[model samples]
Target: MESPDHILVVDDDAEIRTLLRDYLERSGLRVSAAADGRQMRAVLSRTAVDLVVLDVMLPGEDGLALCRDLRARGAAHLPVLMLTARGEETDRILGLEMGADDYLSKPFSPRELLARIKAVLRRTRALPPGREPASAAATLAFGAWRLDTVGRHLLDAAGTVVALTGAEYRLLRVLLEHPQRILSRDHLLHLTQGRDADPFDRSIDLLVSRLRRRLRDDVREPRYIKTVRNEGYVLSTAVAPQVTLRSTAPTDEPA
Candidate 1:
């Protein structure tokens, strides 16, 4: 719709990749393609891409392994929308865990695929700019391991970094911002999503449920975030601000 934006299509199936390439071009977006991880890396080395349309099942390494590798090395930051044949809920959850911004099952319409791509890109572009790089703080320690918000990464009692989706991070940030203060669903929805809180939607509840599971906090008796019944939710612990990352060259490196 807007001018042509470059998108990389990575899938072992050449037919699907070709079809998407042409369709995306017709939609006013330029598209690149890769058959596997190696080609994906080669293309990445040569061309700049805005977003990636990736398949979970690849030739050699699976998509999740690649996602973790990219994060560890800080190689790429492009938002990814996964395409998968698995229609199970576990597959959907795993896709999110693999750093996919969004997902779609097989037998999806190309128009629907386009819509999902747009949604993922829009959501990713909307996140606030972080003060530091993602790897700056792997784990944030606030009040015990009960409250941790190190940008996209949270931490547990064992000090292991916890993976959080974009929405979960945003929601957690909102609660941590006003710890101990009661914020209604409307306020939270506006603060975190910049959208009106739906009276009937359970998006917030679902995110909280996922977060609690990862944090190892029981929903019945929470220690970090507590439910206020009709009002909303509040962080039960205190928050300490993140410090700026420092260069370690003894402050004598040449400018």
Candidate 2:
């Protein structure tokens, strides 16, 4: 049997913590709750957390600070879903800029939160829910970058590994798949994130910015991925698949 995804919820409100723990657990996810950053660190040290559902307004060391700390502390791979108060667009944007995978405003429905959690997990794990798996290992070579689909790693022209976060990898892969096509935020969100994007959500754009930095593409005069005026972003490079080779024993032994 597949293990349940473990989630760590950090919120100062006792009522909110209890509410989320009960609700998430009922949704078939293993949940751990922490009331503050100190408690959050303690829980993280002991458990293997798959995702963190963090409340933006904590008593001390708010969610944004904690999220940044997490990334700086080598927890970049861990997915974070921020819960901010409704109408706090600035908070939501800051959370995304701080390396959060997704965000939801407070007073949210349990069902919506559950869906967001699943979507974040799908993207973080690079699993296509309800989709067919690739027949073989696939690699995409574009410009000076080589993406190993099976290994989920990127290599530059010199063959050095280029690290990518979950969101960055997903966004880059989606762009690579649809080269030269203008992908709107909605389409990109659904394709790479496995969820519908809210109109106010700018996480996709923030993710693209991060990816661009990693690729060292100039934001003003981007060479690889370009921004379409009043439209969306597009990968202008040509992408080609690299063939995978299998090794076999020699048919005849050498004399």
Candidate 3:
């Protein structure tokens, strides 16, 4: 039998930690709690955690910093669900920018948090129904970059590997699969994140900006991923699939 998914919960609030631990445990998941980044790291070092539920406010290192650090340490594929006391849009944007898979504001319902956790895990572990697997193409080439669908690495013209966060890779893959077509923010959000975007949600736009940065595409005159005035964004380039040997360069997560 497969082991239950392990969750690492990092928060300074003892009550919150205990609350989540007990709540999640009741839901048939193995959970470990940490007080801060130090304990979080300790747990991560010794445990095979499937997901991390990180709080933005902590004792030493904030959740944003820790999340960024995790990405820098090549844990891109590991799902992270960020929690923040502040309901500000900037906090959510920063969390997403730092490679968080999902964000939730504090004073949230445990049931809701559990739902989000399951949603994020589902997204990271498998493709949604009716969606083709990335493995269908060995490599997808567009412009000067080639994406190793199997290995999930982005290769440059010189075959140098460029790290991409899970979110970035998903957005890029969606664009590449539907090149030369305008994709509204709602559509892109649904395709990449498996959810509809709220009126105030700009996660899709932020993801596009991050992806453009990864591709080194100038925002003003992007050769690929062009923006349509009010509709949305498009790849504006053709994607060619190549069955080639994968890059041997060392792979790391996005910083």
The per-model lDDT (C-alpha) reads 0.69, 0.83, 0.86
Q: Candidate 3: give the clashing pairs.
A: none
| Candidate 1 segments whose C-alpha is farther than 4 A from its true place | 1-3, 75-77, 128-168, 177-222, 226-234, 238-255
Candidate 2 deviation (Cα RMSD): 6.4
| Candidate achieving higher TM-score, 1 or 3 | 3
Q: For candidate 3, what is the lDDT? A: 0.86
TM-score preference between candidates 1 and 2, better one:
2
Better of 2 and 3 by lDDT: 3
State in Å the error of residue 193, model 3: 1.2
What's the TM-score of every candidate structure? 0.63, 0.84, 0.91
Give the candidate order by descending lDDT.
3, 2, 1
Minimum summed lDDT over a 10-residue window in model 2 is located at 246-255
- Residue 178 alpha-carbon offset, candidate 2, angstroms: 1.1
**Best-matching candidate per lDDT:** 3
- Tens digits of lDDT, candidate 1, 101-184: 566778788898888677666655664444345445333355655333334666665767665666667777777778789888
The clash numbers for all candidates, in the given order, read 0, 0, 0
